[model samples]
Target chain A: MDFVQENSLAVFGPDGASNPIHVRDTIRKGLWTSHTSGLADGHVQGNVVILPEVLASDFLRFCQRNPKPCPVLAVSEPGQFTLPSLGKGIDIRSDVPLYRIWRHGEMSEEVADIASLWRSDLVTFVLGCSFSFESALIEAGIRLRHVEEGKNVAMFRTNVQTEPAGPFGGPMVVTMRPMPAADVIRAVQVTSRFPNVHGAPVHIGDPAFIGIADLAHPDYGDAVALMPGEIPVFWACGVTPQSAILNAQPAFCITHAPGCMLVTDLLNHQLASF
Target chain B: MDFVQENSLAVFGPDGASNPIHVRDTIRKGLWTSHTSGLADGHVQGNVVILPEVLASDFLRFCQRNPKPCPVLAVSEPGQFTLPSLGKGIDIRSDVPLYRIWRHGEMSEEVADIASLWRSDLVTFVLGCSFSFESALIEAGIRLRHVEEGKNVAMFRTNVQTEPAGPFGGPMVVTMRPMPAADVIRAVQVTSRFPNVHGAPVHIGDPAFIGIADLAHPDYGDAVALMPGEIPVFWACGVTPQSAILNAQPAFCITHAPGCMLVTDLLNHQLASF
Candidate 1:
């Protein structure tokens, strides 16, 4: 919670949706620095990844080879913080809700602004997150257990291998959702439209199939309730890039804090396959 | 309506879903000949195409090249009467409810069974049909105008060109559905999951954008209501193959008459992208 001010008023009126730029506007002015899960409804919220120019090409190739886990919503030129394609005006250096400074293999600090850390050789990558598809699923009346329980989704490291590109290769990470057997099919249908996000579930029904032995114990995030008769569905998690980065242990990088994300001007509907 | 005995009871149990074998049994005995819709609930229904060996390769290529227009669910070996892949005991000649027989590029007769017309050189192809995705859409609570009005979905020829394979190339045909702005997104999401069928829409919004001149006057099927504020959404239609068959004018061929399809043991949920 390191943002400047609470300006939910400027972004959203009685209609309940604000221009995505307003959300960025608040963040740019240092008014807000928190999780952007529901801000600027119908717009894209993304996972942030910043790395030195040397590692950028391989990371981009890794994203291209493993799109389900690392869909590139926007990528910045070397040392350039402005992602003009994602919005009319985007200053990537300080637009995200929060930033995590990674030195070697460990997180060093949680910061609200990254202007002082911005370097001429740093490249930024914005990967699509699951929020866009989740909105679509909710609209279709398919209940998400974690959303209802108000907990972070359960995530597990899977045996499913990612297509390797240089030092960016690692086992895929996936987020889990528990739903009735009937809703699983509908969930797949709704999420498949937003490939820019995670697209469709990588595995469904049995957690064992993806090498998760226990539903109650997830490697990351809180384990939501998995009621009887409900199957645990898994989608390639955005944390996969973090996992890869951790294994590769790049010299220096910056990413959004765990729950915090970068909100962009692009509409969720615009990411749809149709 | 022209097949044999009326045995919807043997196929569907009291709860409405029966073993797919039962549906095939009734068809094998010449006991059921009407449209297979609603029978064998949760099972797959496929569009059938039978052509001589000389034309099979080209047709197969066409299906592969244009999966959205003609998704191949199952294909039989040349002169093969039994589609063992689709079911346990399926005699392609008689399992279908009814079929249209063609000779020298012209339709010769609409008959109850193709047993009298089965040929050793004939090749059978079972294509994924719209019914699979349509069932998923309705179950997700997306209202369809054609399904509500009890009329066939309105279809039109589009300027979108199909990938040509030998003589199988033709203008793609698309089915239209009208819905308010809100449901349009959900419909696009729902249909995208069933790529084995005609996955996701090829076009949304104005029909003219895809070369359709009149939504009121469709080239095939009946047009339903297009209310104010509702934009017309279009999906690649399965009828593209039928249109190709008519234009290619193969010397001899057989297809399930429009609306009648081969019901199989595969569940509709099995086609989901997850």
Candidate 2:
């Protein structure tokens, strides 16, 4: 593990949820760089996607065409790093704990700060992440195996095709969480309350139905064992844009590193459509 | 056929849409005393429940607890006959084409107008109906077999229990529509967009899962056949509140008779949370 991972885990201990604003404030000043998974409770965490203005419109269309996998929370003005709408003074260039640099859709480097790389032509989009709804599920007493085991949630690339927009065309990527049949319905009802995040399960039951052959081997993230009577519930993942970005092969792009997120001041309840 | 069924069907052509405002206007002027099904096009239709202010608070809790089936669109002030929020000039006392008077939950009489029975302490609740989302499903090109065969959609009294509110507790009732598997997903997605009108589906596939023993037999409305390769889709029905009302056995309550509804000026689009 690197310093980013170590620092993230340090600030994400059991008692790290005192104040999300202060936690984020520390991260922006380079005092912290880590995964944001368990850092803040009840606040909205976002998957960051930064691209050149030239590719911004096409990416926006990609999100619109495939809303389930790419629900947009807030889009920042071109060349502007501050996302006051999502937080008081969230700096997109360095607020996220870690960022992955992509050159022509291929990840080139992972860094704690993007302030040096920030350019006048860059645009930032804060897309809704599963973390928002995961908190809701946990509060509803639905056990999340990944979180319990302290591992990244399991994700897979599915044969399920995404709606094409401009040059952004690729298969949808989904994350899996195992739950009993009865809890599945409750999970649907709870998650449906937060549409800004991935609303409801895109697919449930046998993974083969969605063209996923093996449960033990996930394309990304850590795989947890599925207990008896538990079925894998698949949801449209924020990682979907990564697949789209890879397919579109933009000249330059930046995204939050896996497990690292942009913690916004927006409350999870505020995102509920109801 | 009885006068209500004969008149309701007669008011609508084989393929024509019956406008809600026109139907309400006709009923308000004593021109009709029939069910309002098949009569609203692109308008919000509601299940009417009129109760005295004494029992209104408990009923409100019932609706809030069971939103899927009893989504409250608009609640009227005590003794008020007009719902300014739902329509341009909807008179709760007469906007419905027909109304049923229930004495202690038992059917007393069917009347064209409720003005004669109106009391100063009555409070009206307008609960959303499946018609709103059904229209959406059909518009999305999902074929509804019962509609094609010119029969009322099949509805069943399920063994699934609703969250009990003070004096208002009963089994859930669901409406069924059979469609291909692809359409079932589309139905979920489309209906999920309109939470105000019995949104999405409560149950799908095997009816036995939700404790419905037989598909060909339903407790309310006419039975429709399910063709091979078609799966039954169940939605939270407006009948749920009526069932609760019957369970509570509220004295001197009024509701729209089966197939009869209160049409409002609110457009269906206004109900889409997305």
Candidate 3:
């Protein structure tokens, strides 16, 4: 499938199908099986995690304890595949562009759809991603380097530990963006309004303070160059929850592949607390 | 006069006179004459710039062009000493605790009352100060070091130039606050709400980028200590306009002495843009 052509048709082409439902429809039909960034520009894209009913409550508690990294956008009922709250027809089994099957803290396989592997006791959780707040920052005229470079933001594992809940515990993960001093202040103001999507930065300047020693080498994603006048700004990343879930080592679990998120009907502006 | 005892009585003592009116009345009656920092805790304080009517419009234009530095809160009609717009009975001539009489770009005298110097051609311009935003930052649980040490905020003249209107143009002045990385982010958000009082920080990180050679020495105000892990955040200061006026060498001008301000009936929270 030509993912770029499908995204263009859904977002800005003659079809003008810019809504999330159309994006999800394309993903559901297996016509687009790639990263979901910039497909639904102003809509909220979420991180997906599926666990058995027995372990759902503990994960929910973990999300509550550390909300900055794992803001809960929607939770599906046991054995339910449709998320009525997020959209009209969001099928948890096949709406996502890609899914990863996990077994005992290890990734087993990457598949386009998870309908055949869906079980009766599975529950889905959608966590807020940084795409919404990043859109806000860009709209406010602060240029993000990763977006300009056409690469994923740099993510790092920090020594700062998250509050443990039951069997879920690990070091918090953070995303870094280097910006000039003036834009850094404006970025803080713009992102602070969207509390549901990892609002405001956790650490800025001197990555060593957050236990990340090197800016050139990140734990995940490609790192862009940091200019002389620019200082690195860090935010609590959605990857933190995924790392915790992996550490918990549930017998059978499923998650959306990195950068392949679930597009929801909720607008980015709708998540702003102010 | 015992300024400390008067401030205590007006703010926290048994007198229980914490209102702006009480503070103004004490100043008007010649009982208190000093900096009005901690008095009237939640009200707005203004920087005063009185000029002849011939130069008033140009000054207004200068303020409009460079709002971040000279945020005009209220302007008085020519020959009018009582500012009904700011408060019920704000006698501009005698309300402020201290006044500076300037002649030909030099300070001629320091007086407590300016009633004898009032002229029919004089126009009073009340510009917003940083006190309102500082109060908001402190209230939001961010510690300000200068406030804790009972010293003045550090001020420096930067290389950044202001938009010139007529003969009013000079190097922009900025106030510096050194804080940890987290508090720096919070301070940006807190101060961003008060647009009338220097909205957000103009610069952060390196002081040399803004043309300040030494952090230990400042052009105005007392220098506060910057800790090892702290970074300096800079905001556009009200002193920019005063410096411009002095450079223009206006024949007859008056201004409130440093740290002495005009207390208004408006509350600090009322100035929030959100």
The model with the greatest DockQ is: 1
True contacts kept of each: 0.17, 0.00, 0.00
Query: What's the lDDT for all of these models?
Result: 0.82, 0.81, 0.85
Worst 10 residues of 3 chain B by lDDT: B1-10
Question: Candidate 1, B90: how far from true, in Å?
Answer: 1.8
Q: Interface Cα RMSD per model, in Å?
A: 13.9, 18.2, 24.9
The model with the greatest lDDT is: 3
Over all chains combined, what TM-score does candidate 3 have? 0.51
Q: How does the DockQ of candidate 1 come out?
A: 0.08
What DockQ do you compute for every candidate structure? 0.08, 0.02, 0.01
Clashing pairs in 1: A3-A32, A3-A33, A4-A30, A4-A31, A4-A32, A5-A31, B5-B31
RMSD of each: 13.0, 17.6, 21.4
Give candidate 3's error at residue B100 in angstroms. Answer: 0.8
Local accuracy of candidate 2 as per-residue lDDT tens digits, B108-152: 998888898999989888988888887888889998887888778
Per-residue lDDT of model 1, residues B45-75, tens digit only: 9999999877875676577557788977776
TM-score against truth, every candidate? 0.52, 0.54, 0.51
